[model samples]
Target: MSLPPPALRALQGLGAVWTAPNTLIGVLGGLAGMLAGARPYWSRRDCALVFREYPWGPGGAITLGNVILHTGASLEIPCRTYAHQAGHCTEPVIGLHDHERAHVYQYLVLGPFYLPVYLLCGGVSARNPFERAADLYALHGHGWWPLKKR
Candidate 1:
């Protein structure tokens, strides 16, 4: 049987994409929130409501519902609802500037390999080394945009 050229084959192979699981979703959201400059910082009570409503997904940390960080992205209480439900996550509901920026951070650090690896591994609970670095950057030092009040 005839076959495509080696170059064509390689390019086709490159086109194949691997999607992440729900577990790993948190990071994406967290990263987005960070970039948008809109973190929850909601009162503990509001946080609880968020948690009760959305519930925590995989590959992230959840405290009642106040905060959600997975991979590099996250969503805080109150605001998270908008981001989560609408798939947008804007201010009043959720700040998108930080979220988008955080995605950039994830792109930079995790690279293309991160998401594929995350999907292959299954479940987002495990904290990969790259994720740890981003988290550290977000927690301690001033990394990128939409700086959250500490």
Candidate 2:
């Protein structure tokens, strides 16, 4: 059976608490990015903090807990046009935000273990189960957990 609203909320609160350490790391990174001319905003849709024009990392974006640091003007795929060109994104137009939100959910579930497990799984590569799961979640809106059997 499904949990009631209060129970669900309590569990969510507990999750936030569990993930607070990772969130602190994200906040620190976001603060550093902010000092480098990045803009921070809250995405209610993704339920996470997003930093645009982030000046660090290789490029693209990175997700730490509930924070997403993007090196673009927006989290949308095209970042400019609303045109739905083929090969740009999935059917529902999921983008980096959706992918990063999956990481946030992962952090909520795994807490402090998320980073160690992610690195052990292969950092950031197609072979990484976590990245694959995040990609799956972005495309299909589910399957956020890595190594989860079908």
Candidate 3:
């Protein structure tokens, strides 16, 4: 068989120069979202689920606290569904219970050690080992976890 493209091969590198910047930004945005959404009473099991279930996880869960400190604010989720179809509901659905629970979850997962690591190496490509792992988890949504037959 013919050889694979060089660009594709390079992408496998953790510190690959081409995709590092974008990956770094994604990591940052995820961390910021997590930090701004904290709650004290939330539990650890719940946090792990969020880190496991969502597209944003691992590093995203770790640096959340530091991002919260810099922003000096909280993450505001959309209270209403898109298209302004209905009034705001005070409670979230069960499947979505952990949807916006990033902040507290992040704190639980990494404790106080995540922020500095994020600051020092968040943008480095190799620092994102979990990115591929998370991607593998999400691939199930693309027909891997297809709906059941009636």
Candidate 4:
């Protein structure tokens, strides 16, 4: 059989997409959520939008929602729940805004490997180093969020 066209071969590479797991998931999930009556829009905070409500998860699921971001203040994807949305301005996160943002950076740094790294650290509320960093950002300084509340 003749080899597939160059364009087709290139696009097929997406099947192994690992440069940004969250981003990949976000794009696909966001599209699906959008079609499922959920609206995907960007937030004023420069985050990706996917009019889904990614709450804290059920059955004590720890963290919830689906948001992916690598470098800047942009979030990708949105789940059928509250992924990463606050108001018309920020993500739905309040006390943990900084923490969540840290994860976004992790995605950026780790790219497609972020998911595996995060999982190795601790799936949900396991106090993994990555999570620690985010928590620190919110509780500590130099890159914290809440600022220890004095």
Candidate 5:
């Protein structure tokens, strides 16, 4: 059921175009982070640009589309300190890069609606379907999309 190579490439190209607005925002945010001493690096595994050691925000990491700004040395480290402090770290730690990459894919699918829909889904809360889906993908390497019930 997977798309053929040419079809997949076309679809991906369309997705990039569709998500360009959000990616622009991500680029702006990345630039700001860079000003704060964050170093940029391309992650082949995540297929996104990462700004490590970002000095602002509430801490940990934030994904603005194809960019991830994180307050850490590397994305391999666990970024969910709040989860651990709240005693909700029962599951294995999920890679921060992978979690943010899920958001990139979400942007590709949702395009201009991604930000509004993300806010409607409860922002950063654990109860948010977007966050849940990201965690699911990070933990299991699939299920990045939040499917609606029929």
Candidate 6:
């Protein structure tokens, strides 16, 4: 896996630390994504340890805030049809790539705090400027979710 740019790395690191309060939760959420994604490679990678966060009861559902999966998000979602954050993400649909990629930049720019800001901004249903930009950044036609669509 190639690493992000130095500046982005630094920013994300800082965001992780600064937002440690919430990032702790995010870490747990992200861990879920990682685990599911690693399933096919776990034994091969010699991966050890099980990471799961059952917030409610023994039969409680997984809790993956912004971490979108193929089936759905961590919560009780019907069908999230969008690829999003953390370690693993479902493949992007026709219009969700640029939207989610812009969110990755938000993580770089704001780090952990992005989560709260996202929440305050209404999350998936948000109409905030940041969310708007991400949602519309590359709705036309795109490849990599860079500033300029390819």
Q: For this target, which candidate reaches the highest TM-score against the unseen true structure?
A: 5
Expressed as tens digits, the lDDT of each residue in 21-58 for candidate 6 is 54356446545556555211111111111222323233
Which is better, 2 or 6, measured by TM-score?
Answer: 2
- Each model's Cα RMSD: 16.2, 4.8, 15.1, 12.8, 2.7, 9.8
Q: Give the per-residue lDDT digits (tens) of candidate 3, residues 36-118.
A: 56222223333221222223333223324212211222222222211122332333322122222332232333445434543
State, as a TM-score between 0 and 1, how close model 6 is to the true structure.
Answer: 0.41
For model 1, residues 36-97, the per-residue Cα lDDT tens digits are 54243333322111111233344323421123343224334222322234444232333332
Candidate 4, number of clashes? 14
Best by lDDT: 5
In terms of lDDT, the poorest run of 10 residues in model 4 is 56-65
**TM-score winner between candidates 1 and 2:** 2
lDDT of each: 0.35, 0.78, 0.30, 0.43, 0.79, 0.40
Clashes of 6: 1
Q: What digit string (tens of lDDT, one per residue) describes model 2 on residues 47-149?
A: 6789899998777788787778888889877221112232444344457777788888888899899999999988877667887787778877788787777
Q: Considering only N, C-alpha and C atoms within 3 Å, which residue pairs clash in candidate 2?
A: none
CA lDDT, candidate 6, residue 54: 27
User: Which is the winner by lDDT between candidate 1 and candidate 6?
Assistant: 6
The positional error of residue 1 in candidate 5, measured at the CA in angstroms, is 3.5
Compare candidates 4 and 6 on lDDT and give the better one.
4
State the TM-score for model 2: 0.82
